[model samples]
Structures are given as C-alpha cells and as structure tokens.
Target: MVFSNLPQQQRELPEDGTTNLWGVSRLSEVHRVPVASLRPADSPRHQSEQAEHTHLLANSAQELPPIVVHRQSMQVVDGMHRVRAAELRGQSEIRARFFDGAPEDAFALAVRANTSHGLPLSLSERTAAAVRILTTHPHWSNRAIAAVAGLSAKTVAAQRRKLGPATQTTARIGRDGRVRPANSAEGRRLAGRLILESPGASLRAIAQKAGISPGTVRDVRARLLRGEDIVPLRHRLDENGRGGLNENRQSGERRPPVARLVAAPPPAPGRDEGGVSGIFPSLCRDPSLRLTENGRRLLRMLELHTLDGQGWQSVAQSVPAHRAQIVSELALECARQWQRFASQVRERAVAPVA
Candidate 1:
C-alpha cells in the first residue's frame, strides 16, 4: 500500500527483488526480511520508551511503518521500537525499507529518525549524539554535524572545541563531498601559485579552487602584494642551487605590478572669479566631467563659438553672466538623456519572456 502511493519509478519493483543500493533513492516496495537477520543499530531511544512502545504495539493490531535497514549489513537504522514490537508478537519476519550506506551513515539516519518522531531525543542526548557524530565524521563541518544530530551549530562547535587541537587539524569535508586539506599550509601554497599565475583573478574564485577559506586566500594575496614570500621554501628552490628569490629581477622579466587602491584626484579649481570662459575650470581640467562623447563634442563646439569674434562679443554684451550656467545645464541634460536611453534599451533587451 505504501509503495502504491509512491511515484511510478519508486512503485516499480525490481525483477530480481534486489534493488541497487547507492546514493539516495526513494523508498520502493518493502521487503519481508527475516526478523532474526535484522540487527539493531545504536539507537538514540531510551530503554524505558522502547519498552513502552513495545507494550503499546503488542495490544494494537496496527501495522507499523517499515523499519529502515542497511542493505549490506542488514542492520536496523530506524524503527527499532517496531522491530522490538514484532519480536514481542513472536513474528518470524518484518517489513523493511533498505538504504545503501556505511554504518556511520546509518547511525546519522538513526539519530535523525529518533528526534523527528515520537518521544524526541532530549537536549543532553542530542548533545551526546553530536559529540559522537563529530568523533566519527571529523571531516564534516560543525553545521553539518549539527544537522544530522539535531543540535545547533553553536552546540556542535562547542563539542568540537572540547575535542581539542587534533580535531582542528583533521580534514574538512565540504557540502560538495570534497575533502579539503587537514591544515591551511597546503591550501596557502595552492593559493599562492594561483595568485602568481593569474594576478588579476578574483580572490573568491581562487579560494574556491584551492579549497581554502576566502579570508585565507585574501591574506595570501595581501602578502604577495606586500612582496612577502609566503610560498613554501621547497617551491622557492630550483633544480639548481639557485633560488627563485631573484626570478622577477632576471633579464627581460617583468614582475606583476602590485594592485593598490588609488584615491580619486581632487576636483579641479571650479570656476574662475571672472567667469570669462563659458566652461567651468573643473570641466576644463578633468576629462571625466565631460560625462559623454557628445557632451565633449558640444563643449569643443562652444569653445570654437567663443573664439569667433562676432559670436563672442554679442554673447558677452547680451547675457555674459548666464552664458556659463546655460551651457553647463545643457551639457548635464544631454548626459542624463543618454544615460536614461541606455538604461531603457538594456531593460528591454533583458525583459523576461511571458
């Protein structure tokens, strides 16, 4: 009945009655395995709760959920209470859903199942489970261990700290299932090489490839920029007795320039006291202030217009005071219009399909 509710892929029974156990697979049809072959895994449930559950199941005619078992070991990962209840009823066989993994993985599943169901694991029990998980899965992050053990990451971290320095030097397993180096030295060396090869690469990208923390990569980059030799001594030595210390200084070799944040240049002297020229002094000194190519062309045209004797004298006599203000406003409006048009075009180009 449970198998009927599952999707077509899961509902389909294996022809040989032996499903391939790998990764995570949806629960298929339950198999009636011999009760004598089903060994209980280390359970998080207290003995008192187990006895109470067994008594309840004996009086009721209800069919309990299938026990989760490891395919290779035939060890019960979850539903230990149901297994015990079946024994009390003198049942020769029990229904079971098989999972494919090692014993440590089965332990994680057992802990998760116990906390999620009836008579949840207590705080102390959860902490103890976290400690055990940390000991078994040293590569797992504190958050990952916490997730499996049903405890907070803070609690997991505290348990790890209690485990001492050896734990800190253990390999770290990331969510991607890749194992990182036990210590930061190898990571730093890799990061150093990457930085040397591609000085302009993003720090985050370099860190990811090296499997090192971004902060660590950043520190390595900073040291490189400071001309510090953070690379290991072994890498610094060549096949010959010569060292790579002076490699950059060798003939025809150019070292990568250090990247430094430069402050913006100070704004040029603003407008002159006389306001003789229509252009602001700052605009004349800074090319960036032109805002756009069209704006720069218009400014050049205005300068040529002022050079013409007839245009210059007529403008000076009529509205000399407002001439600069008018020109500046026109330039700003032109730049604003160009920016708005560019933005609209981009928005239309990237508009979502209905």
Candidate 2:
C-alpha cells in the first residue's frame, strides 16, 4: 500500500530568533570581512538608495547591523546600504555572516531579511521581489513567499496566478516548513478507498497512505459507514472551478497538528445509567474490556479523561497567571490527544476486528 509522509514529531520554531525561510544554516559564525573583497550590490531593491540616505546611515550614532553574504560569490545578500555606509566612513572591514545555499535561495533569504529589519522596501520593490522569488521558489505556498516579500498572501496568490504554468504545482511547502497538497479533495478519495479495502488498518497508517490527517482518515471511515461523502461540502471547488487551500483549515497542517497517539478500541457497551456520565459503566460491563490486559489498560486511560464540568473548572482555576499562556497551549494540545483518541475509537469500532 502506498503511503504519504507524516512525521512523528512536527518541527517547532526556534527560540534563537531564526526562521525556516532561510532554508540552510549559516556556513560560519559572524566574522569580519574586507570591505574591498565584497560585491557592491545584490540588493532586493531595484534601484540604489539616494546618496543622502547612505550618507545619513554613515553618520548614524548606533552601530551598523551585520551583512548576510553568499560565501561562494562573496556577494552581499542584504545590507548593501550598510556596506556602502562603511566605505563612506572609511572603515576597512565589516562584521558579516556567511550563507551557504543556492544563489536563488540566497536571494529569497535576502528578501526575507530586508523585509524583517532595516529600511522597508517600497511596495513596488517588494512586489518585484515577490515575482523574482516565485520564479525561484515556485513550490513555496503563497503565505511562504508573502512572508519573505512583505506582501499579503492574497497579493502573492494574484502574482502566482499571473505566472500560470511556471508556478503550477500540486504540493507546496508552507511557512511551518511542511509540504502538503495544494488541495485536499483528492486525498479524501484515496482515504475512502484505503478504508474500504483495509478495514483493520490503523488510522495513522491509513492517514500516511491517504496524504491526509489521521483525524481526516477517521472522518472518511465514519462517512463511509454512514453513507456520506468523504470530502466535506465546503472543500468542493466553486462554480468558477477555482481550487486552493483554506488558510484557516487544520488540514495539511503541522509544524499536535500531526497527532500520533495509539489506536485503541472504545470498549463495547454493555450497561448504561444514561448521559455522558454513563459511558464508563457501559464499558465496564463489556466482556472485551473486562477480559484482556490491553482492554483493561484502555479502560484505565479513558477514566483519566472522564472529568465532569466542575472537575475541569477546578483544574482550570488552579493554573498560575504567569503559566496561563503555557498551560492553555498545553490544554489545547491535550484536547487534540483526546480528539485523536476518539477518532481512532470510532474507526476501530467498525474495524473488521476492532
């Protein structure tokens, strides 16, 4: 069976202030470089800044920021003004960091850095930068290029449409650094097929095979069992026949977005006192859960998550103010774990042997 990629642990952003947009790490630590050895310009701007601008920068009281230079070509990726100002001041050398990457990616990094700090690029200059980056990084999603070029994702998408076949691609690398399908409709069809043919397959196993999330895979199985479309109504292309990802969707997301919890069956129901509170007693009476070690382990795990309204309130109230953000994020992640757990339980209930 064919399967697509879903990493065990999604990549997280660094605290050191680096970003995924740069692609490759620096070739070496920051060090001084001879002013004469560097190329004059490879800036994101289309034209040189006015002489007064550089002259003013040369006279600034603050220290100048380091330049990012391509190690091989010895060309400046960013900081053309800084370099020129140094020369204006009669400084012999400048502090520099080296970039070891393809020339095209170096330009992408330059655009990103220029957008981040220093004098802002003009609207036209940023638009031009987006166009250039599209040619080089065609596989990057609209948001990724938008981030680098300081344009809105919509603006980048418009430019992408103008580029036509040059930028046409089925998969794109998002800002989080995970590559996913541009549209998910096709992946749902595949997930439906996988579920029908291999009813016993685990949700993660099928999710990887479908190029969709395990949550999505579980939805597909439930839809198949209930006689519904595997693809959601909103996901369908419109009358204009336009197809694209919904930026708000958690589909094709990661980087919990890719929960990998174990697949355990929801115990067969045998008794009930009623509502949500009755779920435990119902499962407790089932022989499948009562008889086996793994089944008993499943019961024990479920017991921990069976908190009532006040129980949850007490836990929420106990959180310290300083840890509010951290605890809230962790709570959301814990909820995702429960979601994956419930999804797998439903998929397993209808499994050939689950």
Candidate 3:
C-alpha cells in the first residue's frame, strides 16, 4: 500500500509551535531532502534550525500517528516524499488516501515523493515493498510490482516466497510469552487425510505419515473433532506421571467425526444374484444401473421390450441375490428420474426459447 499525505501547499507557519502541520508531519515522518529543495519563501534563516527542526519533528515524543486523507479512491496523489523519508528514518507507519487516481498519477507521486523532498528508501526497502505489493494484490503480477519498485521479477518472487501468505501470521508467542510455531492446521489436515485412507492405522503410523509427533497428531485429531482450537498443554507433569502431556488426560480418546469415514462402493456386475445368473429387470430399464459401458449394451441384448416378469426373472437369475436387489433398486430410481428429466426437457424444447 502507498503511504498517504504530503505537506499540503507550503503555507505560513502559525504563531504557535504546533501548526496545521495537521499531522502532515506529526501524523507522518519528516522526510529529509536537500535544504536547497525547499522554497526560500518564509524559509528559516539559519540552516541549522532547518535540519534541527526536521530531526526533532522526526523524533517526536509521541508516536507518529497514521495519516488520514479524503479522496474518491485509495490513491496517493501528493506527499510521497515525506512518507518515504519517514520510512527511511525507521518509521513503521505512513498514511495515504484511496482515490480514483490514474496509474500514471501514482508513478509521478512516487517519483516526486522520493526525488523532490522525501528520504530515499534503501535498495532492500524498495525490494521488500515490491514483493509485498504483489502478494497483497495477487491479480497484479510480480513483474508489475517489481517494475513499480524498480526491482527485478526474480527478486520480487524471492521476497514474496519469504513473506508467504499476507493473511496468515507466522509463529507467535502465547499468553506465557513463549514463542511457538504454527503447525496445528497442517497437522489436523494430515490427520484427516490419514483417517479417511486408513481408519485402522496406528497412531504412530499416522503421525509418521503426517510428519508430526504422535502426541501432536493425537491432540490435533481430538481438538478438530471436538470443534475446539488446538492449544498448547497448560501444565507439566512430574516423575509420578502427575503432569506433562499424558498424565492429566483420559485413556479413552473420543472418536473423530463420523462423517470422516469412507464408504465402500457396491460390487461390480457379472456377480451372481440370489445364487442365479441373469440380468436384473431393473437393470434392463435403468441406464444408470449399468456401472460400465458393457453393462449398458447388455440392455439391448436382454429383449427387455418383449420380456415382462418371466424374462426379467430369467435375466435376474444370472446375478447373486444381494447384488440383484441393490442393482434393481438403483436401476428403478435412475429410470424414474431420467423419465422425469426427459419429460421436462421435451416440454421446454417444444416451447419458445424466450
């Protein structure tokens, strides 16, 4: 994001020490430029006062507040130099407005902000900003941000990879103020994939597959199924098994969500039905009942048009009893839905497109 605000047109200094610098300076950093760059009109007589005042303002007692500007869109028009100068002074924050300014406008502002009165950004800072902008605006390619920041595409890409997702925070310290890495989400996702693929897998095997410790896998699985955040354990155990990761926990862990289980598909065709060998009646009528193209073609061979109950029974005898029943039901449902859909389509096709 571009920093906002610039010294509004140079005006007479107010009688009071605090003028309408209106946070133009206080809200931002005092950008350092050649003393000669500033106009001589009402300029300080002493060169030392100019630099001293600039330095003092840059190092104010209070933190420089974020700048606020009113514009039609979030665009930086003026004050680019001041923003860059402050940033150079190790200032962490700068403010800018979002307005409907053209791309060229932003470029001019950036150039003027730096060359005219702004402190220049080091090579590293420009590279970081270029990379940061690409990540923040993914639709804009690395080339674009790099072009604006005056860095190469490869440099921008490298910086971005280091930055990772802008929204995701890196490792953070807990309430105890101890720093910790964020692995729970990855751990939980791995655990879920393992549970689906191998329900009977041991915890150790699962953890190995997930690339996390068994204890971590266990905790992640538990918290996920329980709809709780995976958190660090609160206490430690002693030699008596009184604390640590396991001592306080229960033996019988709760199961993961039942929805996580994988369901098995039905047996394929050519299998005996009810100890018989024939095509099922419902299979003859329902196209979807055929799992393969071969089974669909078999419908034409069955003489289903002329054969009623007896013919169907003969065909059904080819399949096992259990398989016959399942296939029959599936075929009937498929035929019913297909007929309904076909009817609707016919009606619509007969009507006007409008």
Best by lDDT: 2
The residue pairs in collision within model 2 are: none
Candidate lDDT values, in order: 0.63, 0.71, 0.43
Query: Can you write out model 2's per-residue Cα lDDT over 171-269, one digit (the tens) per residue?
Result: 888786777776677888788777767778999998888777789888877765544556675565543445434632434532222112232335335
**Candidate 1: residue 45 lDDT (0-100):** 50
Candidate 1's TM-score? 0.47
Candidate 1 per-residue lDDT, tens place, 1-354, comes to 222234554322222211122123444468998999987767765553457756776566556667788888888777766777788999999988887777777776677666555446888888888787777777777666676667888788778768965455346665445566645566887888787678778989998999887888888877655444454442343333223445535644544542222222342355233443434333433323232346556455444432434555676567657587887688689779868977996999999988
TM-score winner between 2 and 3, please give it: 2
Which is the better candidate, 1 or 3, if ranked by lDDT? Answer: 1
Of candidate 2, the 10-residue stretch with the lowest lDDT total is 1-10
As for lDDT, the candidate ahead, 1 or 2, is 2
TM-score of each: 0.47, 0.56, 0.23
Please report how far candidate 1 places residue 153 from its true position, in Å. Answer: 1.8
The residue-level lDDT of candidate 2 at 109 comes to 83
Q: Number of the top candidate by TM-score?
A: 2
